[model samples]
Target: MSCGYLLQMDERPTLDDIRRAPKVLLHDHLDGGLRPATIVDLARENGYEGLPTTDPDSLGAWFAEMSNSGSLERYLETFSHTVGVMQTTEALTRVAYECAEDLAKDGVVYAEVRYAPELHTAEGLSLDQVVEAVLEGFAQGGRDFGIRVGALVTAMRHQARSMEIAELAVRYRDAGVVGFDIAGAEAGYPPTRHLDAFEYLQRENAHFTIHAGEGFGLPSIWQAIQWCGADRLGHGVRIIDDIEAGDPPVLGRLAAYVRDKRIPLEMCPTSNIQTGAAKSIAEHPIGLLRDLGFRVTVNTDNRLMSGTSLSEEFAKLVEAFGYGWDELQWFTVNAMKSAFVSFPERLELINGVIKPGFAQLKWRGARPVA
Candidate 1:
């Protein structure tokens, strides 16, 4: 006789299983994820006096506080404290090393951590020195934990250093720096403001992503892709606005173009909610996009600020969308595919690591009960 559950598919990975499953991250912020204890230690060492608290747990809660005003300025003010402490090479390297370690322990097989080189130059470190320090830490951490990590050099969109930062990214392309990005308020300062930098990167065949459709609207996303030639979009949850909701949703020209072109959308549910981009995980556009076959990828945009990790992000989607192992694998594969890594390298990871990892989890879940 057949077993009672043999006909059923294994679904809803337990929290433990989710944590154990291999994950890929492409939008994590380095300064955004420092452990609260690390912040205290770094602040003490650096003589930085701006911390709201000295205790780890309190600092964690403090950092996680969502601004009541919903002002982008207020949202960005939190980074000032983080960037304040991360002025020296030691602080930057320590923060980066712990980043890789934490992600690896969370079952992240690969991650592209990003930061602005200009932000860390306050302690008199050159842009090159800052990049080197971070690369060193990621290398050491990756070697120690058996995880692969890459860097994305980000420029503040509202600043004038994008051209200079683009040059810095190109100079370190052979190093661990895998791509370039422009992040800041997307309202007035558009990606086209840095058109020269984008054009240079395009000439060099370099990769880049733009922060759009999160703070602004469809116009920002249009400029990021059509004008600036962004390879991917950062926190592109706002693209859903272009879709008319229905039993069979209709995609506007921009939405259809994004889907037809398979442009990757780095959707951060918790972060979106924190910033008022989405009301909740269940109401997030990721569900609709995923259902529509958009190349949607999950990410923890700012882990500490959002109080999330790749595993936790996936678990949220799992609960909200009833995602099974297959859905998790799809998201993971989408991220790995959209990574700035070379084609061959991405293929190796998809076949050698992510696929096998999910296969094992699926297998374990599908087994009959004793």
Candidate 2:
């Protein structure tokens, strides 16, 4: 487990060092992380020839470029191709399998990959079938690749099927679905619109995260926590808007409440930049949030779209904020602690896997001072 090269004197950890470090991902879109080649093959098999490019490399570049348009709507439009080829059960299983494999290769020890099951019913697959296929793929991937994968069944915020999706999530809670979520543009369709689904999840003692404070501002975050009772805030980058980074750094009521409650903020740095939530990684609120003791967890919102992996995200933070092994370990532990999995399982992974993994890396040498 020890990467000796990372122990070199006077050296900041390299990308390879970050790759070798264990990671925990709490927020990633299933449809948004498909391999470009998989998309091409699935499209060919399904005879859906609407792809911008037949070549996988070009297709991958196209997705990155489209998602970098600085408009959340334009970024989301890139999903049409991914979702188009993911309608069939085989395709769903394959995509889910590859997602786990890719994350494992990048050193993600644990991940909760989420997708809106309603988006894949075009081929007549039931919501339950969609969940089952994805679960089967994750189970297979875990057996093959030594990584634990959990499914988060998401409902689109702009749609009216939140209650049904919530029901689907509760129904499959013991069958591999770890939690429920709502994703989409956060402006016009607030998390409050799905209050019934949130309330239902609360009643069932289920866990759920809300897509808030990304494309919108403080009001969106306030409503997600105050109104809907979100367990975590998805891309809660907008909380930065309420913080005054002056002498002693004053936090607004909403930001203070989020911090006081220790609600995890699933911050996706690259995706936030792509959506214009943060001007740059150097300017990201995650640095301040971490400094201020907020429960912050780093994530990859969409690997394919952002052209990033969990390792790459960690590397970016290292470069931007001069973070080192200790900072990296802090983020990883935060994510593992915030996972929706059972407390005993979470503790086992933290003690047996994540802690040991970081200890090996730290044993390599002293981390550079942050």
Candidate 3:
């Protein structure tokens, strides 16, 4: 009996294609992607209390259920549980280290994991201590797992601590912090609310990616780019609204600017559908945006919440859009090119790690027949 999977059986890629592919991740949320078993272990160690279930399987289902409600408020509630357990230095270190290990296992060669330091301060640890512990964890994880990891310090959009988080990111830039970000609901709180922090990052010559256009629309993306000077966009999927589709598409001012300027959009297909940003993975606008020359990269916004990984996200795209090795390679290169790392560093990652991986895949077997 046929399982009726989306891709043609003959057209499906080999395991070698999946295992050997190079990947880059830019839009993951550290608080929303914890392994269920790790959460249980951490909770037990900390005695911080309150889990819906202690059993790992039950807890896993609880997270998927809670996050699937499609209300941003309900979705965000799940993070409270993860963040609550990650209060102490030891807990923080363990979670960060496990995050690296998980990503490495899923074939993510490079990643920029993000979390809000303000969330960890509830246990009375200073923001600086939180940064230091997480950095140490990622450093150790990288050495142990052979994956390159960096942290993106996040500021909650609904809160008034962007300036403080901005300072914290700058303070830890040399230690493993690579960039800054603003996340959370975009409907009521606008990007301009945190203009001072963005301005501060600018003066310090720091980089940032804004969470815009996922649940909201084009204006949020416009302000994040034009007003706040974001280096990249998180879930800028809704920018499709500004472009009229045709044989040759026509772009509005904002869409045209985004494409012409080659701004990188971190598009997470499954999370976009779960969060009600897009209707379906098959209908996502990434292909259109990519065809139009905008720099688009695939990502798993919240791996646990979305039940996905970088490899899974790529597999879904291959099924939905018939993307083969070449397309996947281009997207990975796009992510590396758009990463917040310094020029020479980004070049080295692409040339030294990413391109070589893809080159090996090309020589491994016969190319999949179209």
Clashes of each: 0, 0, 0
Measured against the true structure, the TM-scores of the candidates, in listed sequence, are: 0.97, 0.96, 0.94
Candidate 2: global Cα-lDDT? Answer: 0.93
Error of 3 at 28 (Å): 0.9
lDDT tens digits by residue: candidate 3, 36-90: 9999998898886899899999999988888787666678778878998989999
As for TM-score, the candidate ahead, 1 or 3, is 1
Sort the candidates on lDDT, descending order. Answer: 2, 1, 3
Candidate 2's C-alpha runs over 4 A off are 1-9, 366-370
Cα error, residue 222 of model 3, in Å, equals 0.9
Ranking by TM-score: 1, 2, 3
Task: Looking at model 3, report the run of 10 residues with the lowest lDDT sum.
Answer: 1-10
How much does candidate 3 score in TM-score?
0.94
Model 2 residue 30 CA deviation (Å) reads 0.4
Clashing pairs in 2: none
Q: Which residue pairs in candidate 3 have backbone atoms (N, alpha carbon, C) closer than 3 angstroms, thus clashing?
A: none
Please provide, for model 2 over 1-370, each residue's C-alpha lDDT reduced to its tens digit, 9 standing for 90 to 100. Answer: 4433334455666799888888999999999999999999999999987999999999999999999988898999999999999988899999999999999999999999999999999989999899999999999999899999999999999999999999999999998899999999887998889899999999999999998999999999999999999999999999988899798899998889999999999999999999989999999999999999999999999999999998989999999988888899999999999999999999998999888988887777664342
Superposed model 3: Cα runs more than 4 Å off? 1-16, 367-370
